[model samples]
Structure formats: C-alpha cells, structure tokens
Target: MKQKAWAIHFIYAGIFLLLAGGQMYAVESFQLTPSATKFLAHNVGPGPDTPRGALNHLMVNSGADVRETIRPPGWIAWAALSAGAVMAAHGGLLIARKK
Candidate 1:
C-alpha cells in the first residue's frame, strides 16, 4: 500500500520536471525573451485572467517589468530546474527506500 503511494510520487515529480524542462527547452531553443514571459503572464494569465480592478493580484505579482533590450531573468529557468530536481529527488527517495 505504502509502496503504491510512493509510485505516485514519481508521477508527480515527472509531471513537474517535464513541465519545467519543456519551458526551459523552449526558451533556450527559441531564444525567447522576457517579452514572451510578459505576454504569457499578462494575456495568458497562468494564474488569473480577470483582475476586477484590484490593485494587487496574481498577474500583477508575477514578474518584474521586462525591458525590451534586456533578456528575461535567468533565475526563472534555474528556479524551475531546481524545483524539478528537488521533486524528482524526493520522489526517488520515497520509491527506493524500503521503509
């Protein structure tokens, strides 16, 4: 029973890792700038679409203003990669341990 639950951890880790990996690959392979991130954050609204005139919201709190000349923050990719690694390691430990 517990082992089965541990297997589910692999699925969760794989999902997150795949998502972040895909994003990083897209950004690197396509040379995407911060503008793309801004567009997704503002229009696509990964968090929320409607603000309802609120001063502070998920979209508002997402990212810093991206200048046209500068590329997007590198930390975004690193953070995503780090998170995926941590999740993968956690899932791996859960699956490999006998106890």
Candidate 2:
C-alpha cells in the first residue's frame, strides 16, 4: 500500500515536471516582473562591469521600463523532460511490480 502510494506520487510529480518543462522549452525568453527584477538587483548587486550586473542595475535604478529578460538554456528543458519521463516510467514499473 505504501509503495503504491509512492508510485502514484511519483507519477503525479513526473507529469507536473513534464508539463513545466514543456512550457519552459516552448518559451524562448521571458520578461521579469518589476518585483522580480528588484529582487535580482538586490542579490546581484550594483556592479556595472559584468553584463548581468549591468542589466540588474539598469532594471533596479532606471526610471524607464527596463525589464530583465531570462533565456533558459536548451539543456535545462531537455534534462527536465528526460528526468520526468524516467521518473514516470520508473513509477509505472514499480506499480506493476507490486501487483
């Protein structure tokens, strides 16, 4: 019973991850909200030399609309999708084995 429950949880989690991964994969880039931008600026600090720091500074300090853009690498999506598929498959196998 416990094993079956775990299997179900895994299946659900895998499906959610797969969906999120697909969404991330589909969207090439996304804009950061003002709050998110400010948060990043605080964390990233005010250094102007590095590209990330420059962007962060601009978004935080500039009065003009300076939305930060996030471009997730291709590997992350592929990895998430692969992991979700593997997890779902493993869960299915576990459930089958228990029966």
Deviation in Å, model 2, residue 80 alpha carbon: 1.0
Kindly list the per-residue Cα lDDT of model 1 for residues 24-43, writing each as its tens digit.
65574443366674555555
TM-scores for all candidates: the values are 0.42, 0.76
Question: CA lDDT of 11 in candidate 1?
Answer: 55
Report the error of model 2 at residue 24, Å: 1.9
Which prediction has the highest TM-score against the true structure?
Answer: 2
Give the clashing pairs for model 1.
none
Global lDDT scores for all candidate models:
0.60, 0.84
lDDT of 2 by residue, 1-99 (tens): 999999998998889879879988999998998777777777766667889788667657876665678999988888889889988998999999998
> How many backbone clashes are present in model 2?
0
Instruction: Report lDDT (Cα) of residue 11, candidate 2.
Output: 92
Query: 53, model 1: CA deviation in Å?
Result: 8.4
